[model samples]
Target: MRGHDLINTCLPDELIVEIFHHIESKSTRDACSLVCRRWRRLERLSRSFIRIGATDSPDLFVHLISSRFSNVTTVHIDERISVPLPLSELVKKPDKGASSSSALKLHYMKENNGSTSAEGDFDSLCLSDAGLSALANGYPKLQKLKLIWCSNVTSKGLTSLARKCVSLKALDLQGCYVGDPGMAAVGQCCKNLEDLNLRFCEGVSDKGLVELAVGVGKSLKSLGIAACAKVSNITMEAVGSHCGSLQTLSLDSEFIHNEGVNAVAKGCPNLKALKLQCINLTDDALEAVGVSCLSLELLALYSFQRFTDKGLCAIGNGCKKLKNLTLSDCFFLSDKGLEAIATGCKELTHLEVNGCHNIGTFGLVSVGKFCKHLSELALLYCQKIGDGGLLRVGKGCKFLQALHLVDCSSIGDEAMCAIARGCRNLKKLHIRRCYEIGNKGIIAVGEHCRSLTDLSIRFCDRVGDEALIAIGEGCSLQYLNVSGCHKVGDAGLIAIARGCPQLCYLDVSVLQNLGDMAMTELGEHCPLIREIVISHCRQITDVGLAHLVKSCTMLESCHMVYCSGITSAGVATVVSSCLNIKKVLVEKWKVTPRTKRRAGSVISYLCVDL
Candidate 1:
């Protein structure tokens, strides 16, 4: 039907509103609201809003907040994505001018008057007081709110939201964009909040934290305030005094060092999980936590630069019942720490030491010897975990369910054979960048882990189509990432398409050899596929992309980074078809001016539904 004919036949307003509940693409549903006055009423009554992507334009920004976006949770400002911000606040500041060298940096943009260009580039969607008030009035039933990098948001926003939304529970204001005043406002007003994630909200001080502790400690169960540059021992002591029943806590390495760990050790009697992320914490803090929070079962500390064998040993001495541990960047850890864990934490199930450069064969051997119950392990980027380490782990960990050896350069086919012989319960495996382990290793995965669900072998040069064919045929997989491997071409993609009927997410990013045949095959076989990354795949053209978009109605996201064959036509085809697409990434696809205008039109439809 022509546009006018289709308009006349457009379903009744009530019918459209019913359909909106099932539709997820924010822009498309918003466009429906603009179709007619009757549709607008339907959109309003349907309560269709989920995520609101912010822009810097004051007018558009204000209009958005004023709009009645029902369920306005998980807001994403374009600024956080288009104009990327630094993540330097993840580190501790050294004395004197060392602020320049902190791991994360803050860069804020001034308010803009006009809507950003159709280019979709934006400095974070900074909210003003008026905007906040408008938001409070508009979204009185929001459940989750995210101001990840919105620097201009102050305490007033929190107060406004709190006064309006009685059911608000989760809030993420990481990266200090929302400061102490705003945080204090949130604590005071949003008392029923259960999960508060302030990962790097640097402007927050101890006093604000105290107010938070006093207001929501009883109701709050999970809280992560990691990477706050201003957190001191006094504030931690305050938390200890008041926030006694927390089930989960995340502290920066610096905060844990200044006797704050001792406070939590003594104060939080019901804590079960903790994430001590950052690089400044000392071993004493771990010891204190072990002695203080005796019930800790899950621990995630990615980058304690000072953490070593001695520090981990202290953990073995203390947190004996550890069930899950991720020590990704603890570079100085050695066999002694593993020995201690093996001897003490008998229930150790999930373990990840992604970049612990010091751990070697001895550590794996000890874990194999003592931690017989070890089920999941990640030794990614640990260059020293060689074949010997894999041999020991495979033999010892009989119940191992998942193993990630990504970037372990010393691991070879010998490790694969060992793994194939043992660890029959494996479900998920990632071996990216271990070039020495070729087809043999991957074949072992297929033969051994018949229950595998998720698999990733990015940059594993030795593996090819043969291994994927085996995996795709043997295991009913759900997720797979085979990017950066050149030798695995159409055959592998075809095998996966034919075998893995449940595959939803496929990441073939940087694998340039994938052709139209593979893309077509995916569209034909994987009807359940939702996401695919074709970044740097030069062989893919509009033919394959259009097929994928047209056939895969479930496609929600597609990345065309450096896939030069992509043009405005292909993108337009996506807009007209794949009705579920919520996100599309094409950095330099050379969209014509007309195509850019079309893209802008698409954005207008997707902004946010009231």
Candidate 2:
């Protein structure tokens, strides 16, 4: 039997729809659609997500998309033009007798004090209210919508959409021009809205937020308001009074203070996660949180200084259910605060401390002794934390799975060894700029942490081939990054290739000693390798790259910046050999425009940098 007959006889419409539902690749689905009318209908019906750009004829594009994908529940309308026109084409000289629409728009905008209310300006360059109306009229079943940087879309457009798509549950208006009126419309119309993100919406103020809170009320579960300078205490108070069912709230505004936060804590007893940034909140707010928000599980605070140990102590004594905590740039927080938290919040599992220089060994030791369930810990720029803190943590936190230490100058081999010996379940370890850590520590990690799958040691000059060799021998690593580790050479890499047959992602950039031998070893053993970065590996030639591409047929990306030994022929070999190669980043001197064109035919993204 012919292939078509066999397929038709075996695969019914229901089975084909199921197959189409599982096919994620848009290009493959498009190809299937072209095969027959039945497939086209199935593919269109199966598609639930569609992304539209403003560069197309807005009304026509919306009409076609909404008509074709009637069942699409999620739509992302981006402001970015699909293809940017060249300067030469856009810079045509004005006619002697006629005025350009852009010139007239500019004049009108200037007259209106630089306002973007001119409808003509949005007609050609952006998706206007007319297009939105068409979209709303066509896709009434739309449940989720993301309007990213769609500055032309005003409250009128939003009102139209809210009136039509009543079932919309999630809406993200990041970088849009819509303000209180649009939010009010959404609150009044979209009764089922549960998640709303208005980050970077400068025009949204307290009044709009109050209206939204009143409208959505208890149904609003998650709300994000960041970079909205106009939002203040009033909005927070309104949210607290109305949105009692809110589970997650993210606020990044300088106007919020203790009173607002206190209101939220007192009103929203069910609040589970809260993220506050750049606020002038003090211990009073935290005290309220500890007293009222007993169910709070996650709290992240950034750029906070006024709050001291008192506030943290309140949290520790109150919020015992806390599982995740992140404190960044909290310069005023000392060991006392952390100790209090560690002692009380025993359920804590993940903790990230960034730029908290005052937190030293005492706080971390306290954490280790008390927070026995701790699984993930990240310490960035906490210079005072030495081997003592990590030693205690390693000894106590047996369930630890991931550890990230960056710019912690005091950490050394002692800490690494202790961690390796104790944390048997460790799977991911990232050490960056901790100069005191060397091969001894890494070797200990490899020898003890056999479950380690991801390891990154960047700019730790003391780490050498010995570390990599140990890792290769013991751990079946899938991701490795030793960038700027000057001591790493081909021997270490070759050892890794032989041992880590499952290695898929590697970054050996700036490893001057890496050459053809390591590449040959990788090609021979690591068949699953999909992405590699050999940037600044001066010794690697086209021959080495060829060896890598030959066997690693699954390679999807190759970055070879500043590798002088690799020529156009080597690049051509990669493009030809690896059918799955999607991206190639090479130095500009090696490839001409013609070469780029040829490479572009096979690769999805070709970036040439000087």
Top-TM-score candidate index:
2
User: For model 1, what is the alpha-carbon lDDT of residue 372?
Assistant: 83
Query: 356-447, model 2: which lDDT tens digit per residue?
Result: 98999999999999999999999999999999999999999999999999999999999999999999999999999999999999999989
Candidate 2 accuracy as TM-score: 0.90
Per-residue C-alpha lDDT of model 1 across residues 428-475, encoded as one tens digit per residue: 887778889898888888877889898988888778899999888788
Worst 10 residues of 2 by lDDT: 106-115
Tell me the alpha-carbon RMSD of every candidate.
11.3, 6.4
TM-score for each of the candidates: 0.74, 0.90
What are the runs in model 2 whose C-alpha is more than 4 Å off? Answer: 3-15, 22-35, 80-123, 600-610
Model 2 residue pairs with clashes:
none
How far in Å is the alpha carbon of 430 misplaced in model 2?
A: 0.8
